[model samples]
Target: MTTTVVIVGAGPTGLTLACGLARQGVAVRVLERAAAHATGSRGKTLNPRSLEILADLGLADGLAAVGRTHLPFRKYFDSAFVNETEPFAGARPSATTPYPASRWLQQPQLEQLLRERLADLGVTVELGAELVDVRQDAHGAEAVLADGRRIPAAYVVACDGGRSTVRKLLGIPFVGDGDPEPMMVCGDVEVEGLEPDAWHQWFGPQGAFMLCPFEGSTRWQLQASPETDAEGRTVPPSLESFQRLAARHTGREDLRLSDATWLSTWRINVRMAERYREGRVLLAGDCAHVHPTAGGLGMNTGIQDAWNLAWKLGYVVRGLAAPALLDTYQEERLPIAAWTLDVTSSGMAAVVKGIETPGIGVEAGGVGDFTGLSLGYGWSSLAGGGATDALKPGDRAPDAPCPGPDGAPGRLFEQFAGDHFTLLAFGPGARPALAGLPDHVRPVALDDPDGEARRAYGITGEALVLVRPDNHLALVAPATAPEQVRSYLEYLERLGA
Candidate 1:
């Protein structure tokens, strides 16, 4: 088989990349080693940033239908209720922060949603196909499947996992902290006597246990949240262990755990590949960086990796950008991944040290740091500094609930949902200057007396905000200075043409 890109692993990262590419009319093939879809609820929440990305991909409705906002967990100590706390008590929605809530979505549900979306775009996951070998040259790459099928592609991406076959095959050095000890066993199970409203957690001298209701399902996510190593590593989980853990921690014999739907144990992983690309092959998701699962950032970071890479790949494949443009994938995302690891590791360390104040909530997946809203490509060579306010060249394109062309009511995200370079002309004069922009460069003129967008993006006068296909700020130019917009587009033309 032949295609423009061959994606390894069908997790959120790979599926997300596939969808992004396919939507742009790029031929893509996805290979998964497993015979069936996953049952693991590994990544349970899509942080605000991830939610923003999904909204851009036109998945907000589907996610809103299936996913629910997380509620504060009511903590109980021993046999009695102690206090109710929230890891994100202070975090709330505002004009500046549109994605204020986290979507408590199960990983399996998220994947299935992506898969369905991919199917709508004429793509499907090729399961039960394991990569046995890979070979790459200057032109493209070839993969030898375990079942004796050979696939050729212009590029191959590994979203396999922490133990990625692609990363291992490339001999990339994974440099970071060792996996933390006394792992937490996680899975979904049904339990009795727990309120459906608030999540429940019990902390005691020995350890901690919790049962959080998994929205849209009968099961609740069960886990041990102890900071100390009160319990040692055991074998793979069974139903009996879950029952015992629940009975011992909550100190309530009435509550029972049964029918475990998923089971796995994992320690905090702090590692990043030295590089994400080699020859015609690349790595993404867990294959690229494995971090502490704190802040629900691992999967989100990996998904963003795919989000960042897909546009570059699409541009290159369609001869719209230079092959060197692909290099920016590592440049823009690796730092983000490194920063994510540091943040998550620090957060995990806090949990180990019990820094979550008794009455205050714990770190709700780094709710304070914008769950990636603060993440930007400020250090990338691609970011040019000519003008500055709050929204920098490398910052995320902020969303505002405003009107579209001809006073059509819409949000800022609607203009950026498709495959195009979004150009927001904040002034009327600037809109005329961008009137003849290329089809790929979409220009939207905003006339808001309230200056909702102007306040959010810090646009003083007529400003032109160029957003990359992945929705990151590409450039910010003065509306009076059409030369900057012309200059950047010329760069893309030169590289792509």
Candidate 2:
């Protein structure tokens, strides 16, 4: 039987993994419990770094089409306006950083776009086929569905959310506590008299309230502190609950909210999985880490987790890399998930205390920190030693205007496209392109006088930059690293073959 990858949960992460694997001709099956596509605005922002990754995956244009194009967030203190500015201001796109600004789209909208792209690759999610149980052995793994059908796969990834049955089945300890009390009641609602120009939030004595207009739709994401009696009892989460909270906090009888959907009493949960993998069954997305929604990092981080794992799995399945390569997924992602939990918790705590602006500095709980541009895996075993101060091994590979294979004006990221490792030789080098690279290793040569790529990459002269499939730098040498490339591939070959 052909080896197939079974992915549970059809959120952005699972679907993205399916898309990446499908493009590589790796057999994959996606199981979503929902009978139909989900609706409502859950995660609404896609940071700059995520846009770049999506652009490489061929979905950036579709996302830009549906997102609220770089809208600023407006803050208020009760009836008094505090300030209004671009949420990701100053992170503008340039020759090197092609997508520097963040974009906002409802989570459902983004998922649909991903599904469409996955469909183009001839893969469709199997809805209503929930994974009931999973068992793994030396050969592979088997997943039993609720419908009493069992399917075998080379590997299984549980992108199934916070209450993941896969996680529970693995007996992974999730150490975290809920806020006990609802910090706020949040949901999407159709409302009038509120402008959809910017994200609006109000802080006052009654409590904090937020009414951000959802772009591309006549709906607003309404968040408000629950009303409590003298006895400290709050009302149940409902449309009436939100209406009362909005009226009491905003004091704007003119503003009205109706047609509520996806209503829920918000609870704070910041937790990480004890382990990301067990034998052939792996955890991803909320199954691996659950962060407070403060930095908008939950979905973005999960998408990246899927991105990182997809390529690694593709390598192992293609027999180009060792199955042991799968271990690096946990080593690289576990720490990131923990750090994200801490940072986002800090952001949320600070916001509640009114100690910092919502979208300002990284430490001040702003876009600068959440963009993921600053994220790197310097500590990972995969990162090779380097001396460049500008672009270190494990750093995010920057994009720049450079010549394509045909010597025409092109972007460096275009070379990084597809399911492959990329070797970028900057300036004059002995080997402009490697002679005996695997079909997956794409190499490009030369540089520009404008010094765009050179400056961005910190390349003085002949330099070799080896970028991973997920666009993180694996090695950086002052000159060509032909031996290094061959050595790395050979290392994997010894284990895989």
Candidate 3:
């Protein structure tokens, strides 16, 4: 079978990219090696920026309904109560930023949601289809499956995982540190004698143990430093070891752990691929980079990766933009991946050392910017044009309350929730420039009668702000210079040509 794009792996990253491409009217096929969807409470926190991406896909309200937003950190030292603190105590949504706090939900739940969304787009994931090899030429690519089936596509993306078959097949080296010692053994389990209100943590000389109760469920995620035997080999993670660790750390033997749903040992593996693209094959998510699970950056970063690449892929496959547009995907996201690895590694080290300090481990190396809102691609080749006092090219496009074309109360995000670029025209002078925009660009004139939108963007006079499909600023130009807007779009079309 042939498709526009063939995505290997049906995890969050591949599914997200599939949904984004399908929404833009691009044909997509998602292949997963596993016979069915895997179950685990892996990577439970969705940062605010990821929330924004999901919201753009129209899954915000559904996620909010199932996700827990305000779980406090209940810390204990040697089973003695240390303190309780809320990480996002005063976080509230504002006109400029909605979904300001992280939401805690299982990664599998999110995968199911994405699968449903993909299904809504008339696409279904083909499970048990393992990719054995890939071949590509100047025109297109072909994926050779283990079952002797060959699927052809314009591009093939490897979202399989850190031990990616495609990456290895392409001979891309994964470079970084891999700590031999196990950092922690974690899994989902059924627990009793624990309150389901907060994330409980216990720190002792031996190690640390945490039990975070899943919202509206009996399962709790268990994380504990592994125990060693006489040979100094780490004891494999199991329900018995978990129960023993729970009793020893919390000093509560009655706290029983049973029905382990998933268990695995996690080491400090901080690595990134040498490059993200080769010929017609590309890497994304864990297939591209893997890092320490501190600050909940793993799954969220992968989701953002898919979001960043989706639009560019759609434009290229639809013949609306040059293939060079795909190069910006690496130019923008590779740097972010590098930064994630560095910070998450430091965060893991701090958590291991600062076990006694209240909320230190929970904060994970003082990662106050883990919300991912401050990350931008200002140095990117695609980012150019002027900047306002409060915003610049490659900055996140802030949301503000505005009126729609029908003069009804609405918000900027409402205008941006689609597979199209958004051009915000501030004041009447900028409105004319909105005309004759590309078909994929959606223009919204913000009169800012009450100055709400203008104030949010820090626009004193008239200006034109072009927002990328991923909600990042593309360009900022003066209202009088409509040619700058056209020039910027032309530049993107001819990029890497």
Best by TM-score: 3
- Candidate 2 residue-wise lDDT, 1-497, digit = tens: 36489999999899888888988999888999889878878888887788888888899778778876567667766556777777556666788777777777889988998899999987889999888899999999999999999999999999999999999988999887667777777888988888888777777666677887766689888777787867889877678878878777667888888899988777788788988889898889998888778878989999989888999899888887888888889989888898899889888776766723333322235423788888988888788767475977788888888786677888888888888888877766636446667888887775576887888888777877788899999887766566776676677666534
Candidate 3's TM-score: 0.98
Models sorted by TM-score, best on top: 3, 2, 1
Q: Write the per-residue lDDT of candidate 1 for residues 1-497, one digit (tens) a residue.
A: 24999999999999999999999999999999999999867778888888888777778888989857757778766646878866566777786566787878778998998999999999989999999888999888998899899999999989999999888888999988675564677778888877767778665555557677877688788777423324643646667778878777767889877889677776776889999899899999999888776677778887899889988899888877778888888988888887878878777766545523343224534523736777888777667545457778888877876686568777777788888898888878788767788888887888876888898888888878888888778888877877787778667656524
List clashing residue pairs in candidate 2.
Answer: none
| lDDT tens digits, residue span 272-295, model 3 | 999999988889999999998889
Cα TM-score of candidate 2? 0.95
lDDT of 3 at 279: 80
lDDT of each: 0.80, 0.81, 0.89
Per-model TM values vs. the true structure? 0.94, 0.95, 0.98
Off by over 4 Å in 3: 356-359
| Residue 55 lDDT, candidate 1, scale 0-100 | 73
Per-model root-mean-square deviation over C-alphas? 2.6, 2.3, 1.2
Top lDDT prediction, candidate number: 3
* Candidate 3 residue-wise lDDT at 83: 80
Stretch of 10 with least lDDT, candidate 2? 355-364
